[model samples]
Target chain A: MVMSCRDRVLAAINQETLDRPPVAVFTTCDTIGMMKASGASWPEAHSDPQKMATLGCAQADYFGLESVRAGFCLTEEAEALGCPIDMGTSHSSPMLKGHRNKYDPMKKIYDEPNDLPDIDVFLNTKRVKTTIEAMKIMKKTHGEKYCVVGGNTGPFTLCGHLLNTENLVYSVWTDPKEAQKWVAAIAPYCKAFGQALLDAGADIVQMSEPSASTDILAPSDFPIQSGQFVKHALGDLTGHTILHICGDSAPIIPFMFDTGVTGISVEEKVPPEKAVKIANKRGALVGNVGCAMPLYKGTPQEVAKAARASRDAGFNVISAGCGVPIGTPDDNIRALVKAITG
Target chain B: MNDKKLLKELADSVVACDPNRARIASEEALKEGIDPVEAINKGLVIGMGVIGNDYAEHKIYLPQVLVAAHSMYEGLNVLLPAIPKGDLSDAKTAITAVVQGDVHDIGKNIVKTMLTAGGYIVNDLGKDVTPSSIANTAKETSVNVVCLSTLMTPTMDSMQEAVKLINDNGYHKNCIITIGGPPTSEKFAKEIGADHRDDDAQSCVKYVNSKMKKEVK
Candidate 1:
């Protein structure tokens, strides 16, 4: 019997045995093709729940992928927390304009995280609420057939959004205790927002903490600076969760698993075989495809080759190494799905 | 302390990520009659170069790199004004910018710091810079290198546009254009008509230096 898309994904997350892992994008995958197919583009769909749901599900509807995700960018929490944002055109994802609070490393001054809005107020903020509502709509419309994934900024990254990331990182070296205080203060909001997504019908909360990636934080510092806080913000969630850290996460794969997440997503910087070996069945493994290369710029043949390699490498879910670029070619995505499902 | 000790102190302060120590060391180097340019090149620059290499090798990460960059800047603030005004006129010039539609500039900032440490007169156009502005800056300044960066794939088009503008305006012949950031690759660089691409700031600067040396030959 053929397993349902929803069942396949849940099974993959559970690390259950399957003939073929489902082809899904746990990260943001809203493409131009998706926009055209759904008639819901960015900068507008990013705000409208119905449009967001339409665009989010366009992946499964148009490309034959098995999971749906929403909130194309990581700035939702940052924007809701008071950072000015430039909601870019259909071609560009949302970009953070500036930090909401003072965090000048050179001047050695910073605003305490204590003044952040209450957790309830934060959850109900405009874009944050929009994402939750979109999750609900996606669940109602397509959740039975496909998993509805809710993407959110991780706590360390959210803290960086409020305070300047460079400044926060500088503190990690000169004054680590101060940096921990701010990240700890900001984590509850991450947890609350994640729980809200789950409550609103998202099957998985994929938290992207790019700021805490091995590229920025030393591996030794991950546990204290980001991993522990992430354990609370993501691990403590009532539903399944996946933690994504950009760059070569080979160094911190174990640390990421220690967060108690149901799965972890990594970028192509880590070799696919190396990632699986390092993961060692810690949990569900979801990626290794080069989003920039074969997916957006290379041919469909290259995309298929990559997809098969990920499957052969023993990844639980075949997905993008990172958020699928908005301009990724439709043929490449279709090739990825067909490579695995066929 | 002796002049040699003071210079070593300046480098040590930066590597140690202590801005105040770097500042004091810079002042001491000046008091000991060490040339400010030598203090920068032999001291602060050496320290930053070590940090940059460590970052490239993953021996250290961004936090240490940022702090070390901050410390170097603190020392530079002390030593720069003391240098004779025209001493830097022959220094190679470079332009760095985060392309339009992307505001994540941590990578760009690191490149800028590395270029500055490498003795380039880096004109940072800051974040969310338009492609036109980048091209115009390269043309107007006659820079020896143009470094473009954006962390988002959506903004890769902006980087491509900036490179095209530089090429269309005939500035590519005069300057080497390099692109960095997670989304960019050597393939993307070649596709966009850029001269080079690198994953880390140290390699970017090293590439520019090697190319400039070949040009001088």
Candidate 2:
């Protein structure tokens, strides 16, 4: 029997044998091409459930990616938690304008994380609600044919968003216990949001923890600073989970896997063979394609080359190393799909 | 403590990420009538240089670098005010910013700290800075270097635009342009007309220093 795209992705997540692994982007991949193809653009698609579902499915509908995912950016949780945001234009993703609380390490001052919104209240906030609703829409609209993937910010990244990230990172050295308190407090909200996404029909919850990557945190500190909290927030969820951390993640791949995620999505900075070697098939692997280079900047041939490289290196799901650049050309994305599916 | 011991304490304090120790050492240096500029250059900068090199070599990471930066600043808070205002007039100047449409500034902040430690008078434009603002600041300050950074690929265009605006305003003649961030590459830097691209702050500052020396010749 021919496997459906949805089944193919689920199989990949299960580490099941397949003729070929699925081509999907678990990270945010809503681009201008996708926006135009689905007739749903950002700032609007980011909030409207139907538009979000439409745009989220555009990867499968127009580009042949095996899975459909949303919401397009990482700011939703931060915004719901009270950070001021700039709802960017069609060509740009949302940006955090400012942290919600004072976290000044230089002055040794920080606002306590005691007053976060209740879990149910946070899950029901404007954009967070919209994302959960969009997941429902995606399942209803494309569930039979494509896997519905839900993307959320990781706990450490969310806490950093609530307080200033630089200040939080500074506290990691000056007062680690205090830093852990804020991340610990923020983890439940992350868990609640992930569970809400799964409850709403997402097949997989992909959590991005860029701030906890080796670039920011010492590899030795990863398990303590972010990994254990991520385990409770993501690994404990009732569905598949993929943890993505930006930068050269070779040093922390084991720690990421220690979160007990079904898989880990990594950026292109880690060479594909090296990533595969390090992962040692601990679980499903979702990425190693350079998002900026061959996908966003290079030609279709280069895109195909990179995609094929990831495939040949035995990635379970060939996908962008990070969030797809919003302006990535249509042909390049098509090339990625074609290189794999062919 | 004597001046030599005090200066070593200041340097060691920054390396150890001890802001209070740095502050105390800075106070002691001042009490001993040590030239504040000598204290900053030989003490704080030396410590920061060690941290920067460690970061570049991947021996240390951002948290340590950030704490080290804070320690350096704590010492600077005490020593900087004591230096005669005109004493730093000949220091090379630089401007740093995270280009428009992006707000991730940790990398930019590291570059700023390294430049400041390298003894450059740096004017930080902060995050979400417009290309025009960067160009205008470069022109107004007559800086020796312009450093642009962004962590997102979509904003790479903004880095390119900022480079063009700086050149269009003829500040390119006065300043060397450098770009950093995870998404930026040396190829992108060359395509965008930037003078240099580096993955770490220490090398970036070294490149700027090298270019400035050549210009002086």
Candidate 3:
């Protein structure tokens, strides 16, 4: 008999072949049914160790997936660092509230990597520490059974929230060096945060860095802009690592391989075959589902077909090409399972 | 101010986004005595048609394209005032909004700016607007076109519902209702019954303009 689902996933993470490909579901704690079942609630569930561990365990049973990751939005690190997010509603993800200049007026963002508006708040903030604890507990509970993926906001994405993007994009044109200074300030947060999870028994660390993605930035600036720092920091971490960027990154797909990530998650807007071919040349790939289509609106059978298509396209794991929407139907996951096991 | 120079200049004005220069050029062409319709069509509208293509190609960014449309608007704004009133052969109205529940207004704003640049009097409803507001406004304002945008997947259903509400209530019978955004698709448009769908803000102006047809005499 197999040792455990956890062992299976860990072996898979190290690129060791297994009975089947490892599956990971990127989810947020806000899911209605999951929260109700696990009795975990936000801010607390986000930072509470037991609640996070329980919730993390529920991921496999809930979605029949191979990996369960902690933390949904990269905004938390930025929010911890003193940004006010317009959390919008119970349903939506938080967004930086004001124009970039309104809060972070100071240029060259190196003000001692405080995870919150003040240095003290970050130190006390329970979520980061809670999440790490949850990872350890998850390992204790399922470490023998499943793969646990821990996540951190990349340096540039964290800084994008901190410094604000309004001036960042324009400044990219006017002054490259100044932008670099702002980006460099947040590197410590990602490194520390990533290290926290690794220390807690996370088998793989995922960097959810949207700002580094080409959707918002020119491909030419990706490497030195932020990728280099992540490559080094995550490289030093004990577990295998993956980098996920949202949106079409056709122009930068080939170059992204140089970042040293064991895997990359690109969105469906990118042709899966192209991404697969690129990944085949560079490394492993996880997704390219038309997230908006099957995951959000398509029927279970249609979603299963989409899963088959993803497999045909040559992905190692079939998942939402982007973050799984909270509104996603339960049947969608079932369809993915049906497609995979079939 | 012959037919050739006037239209060419109007087209040039839409590209340059220089309203002041465009107005002066249109006036000079008029003084030199050119066919107003020819100048508006061959020069201004036609030039914007090309800019729409470039905008889609990413050959030109927002600032350049918006300013170019502004130049056309300036020239048209001047012409509208000078046109022999009541015989307004080139006036058009359009209503644009960044659908309710979505906060991303930058794209909607750009589309409004482009429409204005292309000589269409646009009703900018700002952002987070409900379908009822759009439909009621369409009825009251007698807009020739209605454009709705939503940037979120959660709100995409609302966008689809907005179009359905408009059509069910007969709002679409009066004016063409359309939608666009990152999540929108031709299939979505067909399922929900949007009269038109545009992937580019600049192209939307052209689509609306093309729908106008031989301005009511």
State which docking tier applies to candidate 1: high
User: Ten-residue segment with the worst summed lDDT in candidate 1 chain B?
Assistant: B208-217
Candidate number of the best DockQ? 2
Could you give the candidate ranking by DockQ, starting with the highest? 2, 1, 3
lDDT of 1 by residue, A1-342 (tens): 778999999999999999899999999999999999999998899999999999999999999999999877889999888999888888888888888998876776877777888989989998999999999999999999999999998988999988988889888987899889999998998999999999999999999999998878999999999999999999988999999999989999999999999999999899889999999999999997889888988899999999899999999999999999888999999999999999
Q: Count clashes in each candidate, considering only residues at least 3 apart in sequence or on different chains.
A: 0, 0, 20
Q: Write the per-residue lDDT of candidate 2 for residues B1-217, one digit (tens) a residue.
A: 8788888888999999999999999999999999999999999999999999999999998999999999999999999999898998888888999999999999999999999999988899999999999999989878888999999999999999999998898879888899999888899899999989999999999998888888732
Give lDDT for model 1.
Answer: 0.92
lDDT of 3 by residue, A181-247 (tens): 6677667667777877888888878887666665446677778777777776565566678777776
**TM-score of model 2 (first chain only):** 0.99
lDDT of 3 by residue, B1-217 (tens): 5656667777776676566678788787677766565566667777776777776786654444545655666666656565566655446778888776676664676677667656667889877788788878887877888889876666786788778778777757778776887677777788888877788787777666676663422
Fnat, model by model in order, equals 0.91, 0.86, 0.07
Candidate 2 wrong stretches, greater than 4 Å: none
Evaluate model 3 with DockQ and give the value: 0.18
Residues A1-342, candidate 2: write the lDDT tens digits: 899999999999899989998999999989899888889999899999999999999999999999999998889999998999999898888899888888887787878888888989999998999999999999999998889999999999998999989999998988898899999999999999999999999999999999999999999999999999999999988899999999999999989899999999999999999999999989899897898898989999999999999989999999999999999999999999999898
lDDT scores in order: 0.92, 0.92, 0.67
List the lowest-lDDT window of 10 residues for candidate 2 chain A. A104-113
